[model samples]
Target: MKFELLKTSNAYAARAGLIQTDHGPVETPVFMPVGTRGTVKALTNEELISASASIILGNTYHLYLRPGMDVIREGGGLHKFMNWHRPILTDSGGYQVFSLAHMRKIEGDVTTFRSHIDGSLHTLSPEKSMEIQRMLGSDIVMVFDECTPYPCDYATAKESLTRTHRWERLSREAFDATDPLWGHTQALFAIVQGSVYEDLRMESAAYLTNLDFDGYAIGGLAVGEPKAIMYELTGKVCQQLPAEKPRYLMGVGKPEDIIHSIARGVDMMDCVLPTRNARNGTLYTRRGKINIKRAEFSKDFSPLDPECPCPACQNHSKAYLHHLYKTGEITGLRLNSLHNITFFLQLVREARQSIQEGRFSKFYENFCQTYPMEEDHSAKNAASRERRRKS
Candidate 1:
């Protein structure tokens, strides 16, 4: 894999580039939808292609636990197993393990954890992570590193950073010792973990860049940190990364967050929000996100978004979608996911165009004004349910 810088905006730190993967060339400032369990939830490969997704992600931990490596290898790798010919990125199972804190025991270089599936015990090390990713045959593979939670103290963050660096080094060595199983090129990208410390971030960045992995991903952010701090840390880390290599922000899904990260020179990203939230009735549009399950849409016969090119907006009405969702029809979820993913891809495409045409600052300003900044549907849903319960 290789990244070719195409252009950079004069106003912001934003840039546009192309990543040459063996599967295909992924335009930079790309949003990779999460297909964590080997599928992108409700949507199929054909639907994902229709929505213009160039790449999707898979989780190492989930795949290893469920289908196991034998199934994937027998199917000739994850691409064939999932029938997704596009570029696939696999995370090193680090974050999943981190989230399983209660069920895991971290010691030295390995973490032993019980499977959320069946409580079966398993261990993961940096070497093992690389081996799993290699077997999965992902176009891009992230290195194994601890993702420290939010509210982490200086001492804890510092210790985690040290462990992460050592693990990353081990990951690189292990990756270098093997070849991709499916006759395709695989790029190993290192994760920079420093929690929220600027000095530790810089230190981690410098250390990883020296090992010279294929690219760099800004990890350990968006883990309950304030939006301002996440943006600040992202900018600082981008400044430390090499200009020629691609810079990815891991697990950042919100539209506003994407805009800010792109302005901060982030090139690639992955998130489960588009699909996961769609399952819960959130449809992201040019105006903003709207909950399809609300009573207001019960008789509303207009399209979800008049200008959206997605199947949900083009071929169906809001009333129909709302009805389907309320009636427990499965198609509703897939359509919503399709629309949200399309909106995200279109947003990134627009940003890339703005950067290439030298109007990124104006684009950013307009996005800030037109797009809804804060919409906590979760809180709204909670309150609405409470009111219904009282009546």
Candidate 2:
């Protein structure tokens, strides 16, 4: 894979670029929909494509556990396996092993953990993680690094940063040991994990920049931090990373979060919020987010978003969606998921355009003013609240 910077905003850190991969070219400042477990939760590949998604993310940990690497390798890698002909980015599985597993031991270069899928014990080292991603045949792969939990003490954060640095060296070595199959060139990105401490964040960034990976990711944020802190930390970290290579903010959130990160110099972001929330009936619109199950939509014969050209918005009505969601029909999840992903993709597309045109600041200001988050709710509770409030 190759990245080229085409334009930059005079007002902020936002810039526009292109990532050329074997599958296709992904325009930068892009929002990649998470297709964890080989599929985007409720949407199909065609729907994702129609939403204008340039790239999609897959989980090394989940895919390895479910379909296993051998099965994917047999089918000629992830593109053929998932039937997605676009660029795919695969995480290093370090985050999942550290965060999702019941028991885990991180020692030296290897992390041993009990599988969240079953009781089987599994061990993953930097080499193993790289090998899994290689077999999966992703266009962009991440290095294995411990995602230090939020609210971690400074001492623990420092220790994990050091370990992450060490593991990064090992991951780079492992990545060098292989060549791409199917004429695909895979780029490796190093993840910087320093929790919320600026000093450690700087230290990690400085260390990794010297190592010269293809890209860098600001990890460990949006885990549980305050929104203000998340934005501040993003600004600090983006200042430290090299400007020439792509900077990705992993597991970042809402439409506003993406805009804020871009203003702070992030070039790429991925989140489960769009698809996951959509499956539960929450939808994003130009005005704001809405719950399709709300009683107010029962007789409202309006599109999900009059401005959106997605199939859901262009063809379906709020009343129809309300009935489908209330009855728990599968079509409700699919249409909502399609619309949410399309909205997110459209948002980043607009951001990229704003940056190229040297108006990112104005674009960002308008976005925040338009789509401000009034509350934080778990998907289920948010749906319930909207339904009750509308009733």
What TM-scores do the predictions have?
0.95, 0.94
Per-residue CA lDDT of model 2 for 1-391, tens digit only, reads 7789889878777889888888899998999999999999988898888789889999999999889978998989999999999999999998898786458887788888887878688889999999999999999999999997655779999888888898999999999998877568899999988988988888889999999999999999887666777889898898988888999999988888888899888899999999899988899998889888789999999888998988889999999999999998999888898899999999899999988888888998788787857564334553564576569
Candidate topping lDDT: 1
TM-score of 2: 0.94
Quote the positional error of residue 175 for candidate 1 in Å: 0.7
Per-residue alpha-carbon lDDT of candidate 1 for residues 211-268, written as tens digits (9 for 90 to 100): 8889999998877777888899999999999999999999997999999999999999
Q: What is the C-alpha lDDT of each candidate?
A: 0.92, 0.88
**Every candidate's CA RMSD:** 4.3, 4.9
**Model 1, stretches more than 4 Å misplaced?**
375-391
